[model samples]
Target: MAKIRLADALVKILEKEGTKFVFGHPGEQILPFYQALQNSSIKHILTRHEQGAAHAADGYARSSFQPGVCVASAGPGALNLVMGVATAYKDSIPLLVITGDVSSQLKGENVFQDVDINAVFEPITLQSHLVKEPQEGIQLLKMTILTLKTGKTGPIHLNIPRDVLQMEVDQSLLDETVELNLPNDWSNLKPAEKLVENSKKPLILAGAGVLWAHAVDDLHVLAEKHRIPVATTYPARGVLSEDHPLSLGLLGQRGTKAANFAGKNSDLVLAMGCRLSERTLKGLGDVPIIQVNLDEKVLKGSVNIQADVKKFLEKIRKTPPKNTDKWLEQLSKHPKTHKIRTNFKKTPLKPQRAIKEILEGKDDSILVNDAGSHTTWVNLLIKALESPSLIFSGGLGPMGYGVPASVGVSLARPDKKVVVVVGDGGFQMTLQELATITELDLPIVICLINNRSLGIIRQWQELYYGAPFQVELDNPDFVKLANAYHMQAKRVDSPDDILSAVKDALKLNKPVLIEVIVDENEDIPLPE
Candidate 1:
């Protein structure tokens, strides 16, 4: 049997599994893998930082609905990926994190660029492995990929020592594949069906699981057939169109007034694929919660169903309970207080007005938002229209996710217009990726909301800590920075000019940055 380097074999396996891109920064420890990548069909995207690579991969996974692959060298390089990994883990985004390790002989001997990468990632990963031999490494890689694709999906880590990657392996030894067996029990769904049937007011709380299961159509069908109003969590925003009469928009903190009102009033809450976080379930007290999820561990409600969300929805769609018209009519009478005042003509434009304008008619465009106070504005105000998905870091809301994730989204869906909404504080974290965007010439529009501070934390300080201290930021001229990267750029300080600026940005064939200046003291309005 012909022998091949383990690194070469690993790339072949990735190709076999339909991996088209690998996002990361290469280093001396991972040079062999980079060399192996040179001859493969897979494209390598070199990010500005290791954190950028991890975030880009995460964004790719979320948009593409595939296991995103990222590689980094040992020590600092691996540590840099921790935040991204944690973000993906919390959100259940599928990722395959590959890190280079010190040679086996030098283990614990303080070799260069060597740290306990597996130990650092063990808590965050679905599974973490250290490759000790070539054959075992290939098998472990195959298993890791399978784990990434199956059951409540999440990231997995594979730490391969430099010498093992360079070792020779028989070609036939790398041909094994791992299969995933997922559960499909419909036994407990009857009680849930009855719960919905008997309740005077029932609501559907959809979460990211609906999107992850590719069950958007089923979800819509189930909601419409039963006339149950749907209130989605942030990650599941676009599962149903916000324009749909049965849609209650986003629910929870920074959620729409109508959605929260409906949730609080509903007698039976059919929480599907949602963890029912405090932010999502706020103001609702002791509602009869029926939770359904693929992972049994996260399911908590009066009745729990552990099954594929799509299959369960399909089953219920076939035999939906009657008498939901009155419920729908009652919800329709609830006033919507989450409206964005687009008519506010003020200098230092309001973030709400800016988000409203950017999302006005771009229903087909994808909105990738970074975590901050600005995110709250976008969540409450931005209406996701036909086929437009909103990507957000729900559980682990990281600051630097917006820009690089937008790059990944653009790469994954080049046909769709990708828009990034990020605050000045978050944007500065990964602003180095502007070069990557220009280099690829991806047509992404970046809506940089410049409030000159860590807006979310500042709000917390003012409300609870008495004063906003240590949250102020010294930001660069974003327009100038965008121009430096050879991209078109503009700054908008007037509310009335926001829509025009966004329209102009959408017209450009390449990436454009629209820096909208807003008051630092402005607070996001809470739902009444």
Candidate 2:
């Protein structure tokens, strides 16, 4: 019956739930939790930015299929995490974010480091709680973790004040059981079985939700049994290995030609754990969609049927699909437009070519992209290996996602190679983190697509505004910048020397930066 501190109780719950690490950035507000970690078994990863903490936790959860934990100090720290949180919310990535807040006495006083974290994150989370009492800490922690298993998984925030950490907790309060209202009947399949039996040329489209559901193996089994050509959304990159014969590569706006053509041409599309966004819809005009999601609301439009992914696939196991040999053959015939063909012999090197070269050298690397034209190139050309997985802030498409996300990915998957492909404009947002990388001894390879222009905006301008304006940028000496942080660096501007220089980078095995200069007029060709 020993009295215990609230922070200790919180850590105990996380440890009991098998949380190996918590990605976070420490500050004065969260010092109690950091001090508590000294006696606990849970490891802490100090990231450069709060966004990185959220993304790192997300990448870890996607790669590991476990709930990721992140912490942020109040105010700016919590605000910085908003983008990553919103991205997770849209993509259904499960995360438990525990942020430290100012003391309870100062509440609503407009105190230093106080910015109403709940109001800022209300729209972007599945649940948000502010802990005022010491006993509420353990209960809230348990509830937050359980929320991850609920229908339509997303981030849950636990806002803790400085005083809550030190408050004494009674041991009997630990026995208070919190109910976990997670879906357990994903085994019912009558409707799904009927849909599978009636359809021909039925294609399966998976999404990041598949990863959250831990149904990748089940998806693969169902696909193989029915001979369904598998296609995944952008965020669900490595859910089904690209090397798998059934995988038609990612399907969407920036997807492979085969996936888009096959999905569009299919008579019935069984969208498993996907939202069917415009990126994947291309141009939807009554394509019979069979949407399976935990959220029943997502099943309303254009959907012929709906069920949970696990139950849907399990039910369809008995009902076999029609022979899709002719359909699959037709899909396979769609010309692959993954390769980027650019004229870069005279001026700056082709950014697409540079990214392709980097992918070839490191096939098994974690590829993270920032918000820019280079994003289009990386999304199209970079191939993910079976291990580390590809990551980006897809929903928010934030400018600094590349640098911070790479930091988190590297920390989570330290054994695997991690690469960040960012544009010059995006890199400047979190470039201060170069010191954080060196301090953490994280060996992440960064390829700065130095086009010296706001590339994505330029694309919009050319398509909408008739001419590009106020999009140009003046880049710094990235090599010297990396050198200042005591990290290895390189620059490649010539098309002929791109591959060779990249080969040398892969061999370095330390935090390295490769700034590849490209012409401002180089455009990412759209499908005709």
RMSD values, in order shown: 2.0, 2.5
Which digits, one per residue and each the tens of the lDDT, describe model 2 over residues 1-528? 889888878887788788888988888787788888877788787777887788778767765667788898888888888878887787777889888889999878999998898988888988888899998888888777776864568898888898888788887777778886544444335555555677777878887777766677889898888889888887877777787777888787877888888777777777888887877777233566767777665664344344457766676666787788887788778744486664447666777777777667665676777788888877777655442377876776778777876766776677777778888998998787787678877778888888888987888898988998998887778899989989898888887776676667766778888888887777887743
TM-score of each: 0.95, 0.93
| The candidate that achieves the highest TM-score relative to the unseen native structure | 1
Work out how many backbone clashes candidate 2 has.
0
The CA-based lDDT of model 2 is what? 0.77
Per-candidate clashes come to 0, 0
* Candidate closest to the true structure, highest lDDT: 1
Per-residue lDDT of 165 in model 1: 95
lDDT of 1 by residue, 1-528 (tens): 999999999999999999999999988778889999999999999998988998999989888888899999988988999999999999888999999888889878887877888999999988889999999889988887876666678898999989999999999987766677776666778888888777878888998888777788999888877788888887888678888888888888777777888888889888888888878878355788888888777878888888888888887776555587887777787754365666667676777777788777345678899988888777777776643378878899999899998878888887888889998989888999998889989989898898899887887888889998889987778888899999899987888777887777787757999888988888876555
